[model samples]
Target: MESFTESLNRLKEVHENEVRGLQNKLLELDSERCRDAQRVEELCTKNHQLREQQKALKENVRVLENRLRAGLCDRCMVTQELARKKQQEFENSLLQSLQHVFILTNELNRLQGENEKLKEEVKRLQGPRLKPQCREGASDPPSPLLLPSPGARKAIKEKTLEGQEEAQDDHPEKSTGHRTSPVAKISPSANLPETRAPDVSPQRISNQLHGTIAVVRPGSQACSPDQGPPNGTP
Candidate 1:
């Protein structure tokens, strides 16, 4: 009977210990549930803040798109205006250039016609003076005889002065060889020395006389005093 009573006490102590363990386990589960609920509340707040930020970002994108469209339209209009202005300026410049070209062409044509007229006039003027060879538009160098020598002008002046002095000594009352002075006076050529012309043959002279004339100076023809007839004679 004492052994049975001791076994029953031992079983009663085990049941109390088991009951305390179950109460401690219940307290731990309640603490874990509270921590999970607090965590869920914090996550819900974070999700609401993220949704507000997404809406703000969407509104900002809409504003930026509207500004970009307005800017593009303004740029296109400016480009069109610039293109029109440039085209107008180019047309004005081209028109002015064409006018200048027309004016220059007219001037050039007038000058060419004038030049041709002048050349024809020169030919017409030269027709009468041209030689047979020259009539064909051929030309010869000028003859050395046509151009005076360097000393020729000086010699001609000296001779002219001497002739004038001799011509002034016309004495009507003077007598020569007991005969009275004739009405005809001694020519100025009497003061000059006797000179024969160049020995060119008559054939050569006739040949060279073509298309040219021979010239003799006035007051140069004179008769020698010895060859003069007596005064009052025929």
Candidate 2:
């Protein structure tokens, strides 16, 4: 009986040691489960962050595309505007050039006509003088007198008329034009030539050609063969 009891005690000690080992293993397993749960929660949070980042990147890409499109449109508009402005400027310059050419052509034509008329007048005046010069090649040079200007020519004409008047005064029978008062020489057609009829008669017209004025008095007596001058006998 004593040997059996001792064997029972030894069996009891072995069972107790096995139970303690099972309890320690259960605790380690529970700690490992808690750590795994935390790791899973961290993984979930990282996934949510990645999803948000992807959404933001997509929005940025969309914004960039829209900006690029707007910039391209602006560039096209600028180019078109520049082209239009250049075309307008070119047309304006061309128009101005044409106008200038037209004006120059008109002026050139007018100058050419004047030059031709002057050339004809010079030829007419020089024709008689040139013939004599051609006949005598060894003749002495003429004096270097200036061609008469308009004012000088008018003075020369007045002197000629005065000389002719003096010569006519030497012969009373051939006297034509009579000198008149300055008041009588006033022109009636000073401002209204178109409204008045010509006060012309055959004798008055003939007298005008001789630088004379003829006046007709009202109720003048007709001259006959029996008439005599007031200062001379008939």
Candidate 3:
């Protein structure tokens, strides 16, 4: 009986030591699990911050795109308006030029009609006429001077003087008299005289020519040729 009691006490001690070692291993495993959970939480917080930064960057990019689109639209509108204004200005200039051309055409036609009438009058005046009266022989009446009418004679004399003045104006060295009057510089268009024949003698023709010249040249103090001959003349 004594031997059996001693064997039972040794078996209880071995079972108690095995239970204490298993309890120590379970406590170490629980501590390692707590450390792994803390590391996972820190990683999640970093991921959330990265996502917020990405969203903000996307918003900024959208705002820049909108501003660029609006600017492009404004620029296109300005360019179109400038083009329209330029087109309008060009049309106005073309209209004014056309009006000017029309006015010039009318003036040219009126001048052409006047020139034709003057040519017809000149042809009529140049026709043949009766011979002059001579005193049996006075060198055939000095060849029957082809005298023009009073008005026509004045016009011819004026035209001749104008041509002389133009010649002098062209060559300053040939001009010996004073400057011509502004009226004397009238264009040939302004000098077109009325067509009419008048009874005129040679002396009368000379006088009328002299009068027309006096209109062009002012302050004439010279004596007329009909006033009197030189003292020695008969």
Best by TM-score: 2
Q: Put down candidate 2 lDDT per residue, 20-102, tens digits, no spaces.
A: 89988888888988999998999999989999999999998887788787775557779989999999999999999999999
As a whole number from 0 to 100, the lDDT of residue 228 in candidate 3 is 28
The parts of candidate 1 lying over 4 Å away from their true place are: 1-72, 132-234
Q: Which residue runs of candidate 2 sit more than 4 Å off their true CA positions?
A: 1-72, 135-234
Q: Which candidate do you rate higher for lDDT, 1 or 3?
A: 3
lDDT of 2 at 126: 99
Greater lDDT among 1 and 2 belongs to 2
Each candidate structure's count of clashing pairs: 0, 0, 0
TM-score of 3: 0.27
What are the root-mean-square deviations of the candidates from the true structure over C-alphas? Answer: 21.2, 21.1, 22.3
lDDT of 3 by residue, 87-183 (tens): 9999999999999999999999999999999998887775533233233343433232234446545555665565456545653333334443222
TM-score of each: 0.28, 0.29, 0.27
- Please list the C-alpha lDDT of all candidates, in the order they appear: 0.53, 0.56, 0.55
Instruction: Give the true-structure RMSD of model 2.
Output: 21.1
RMSD of 3: 22.3
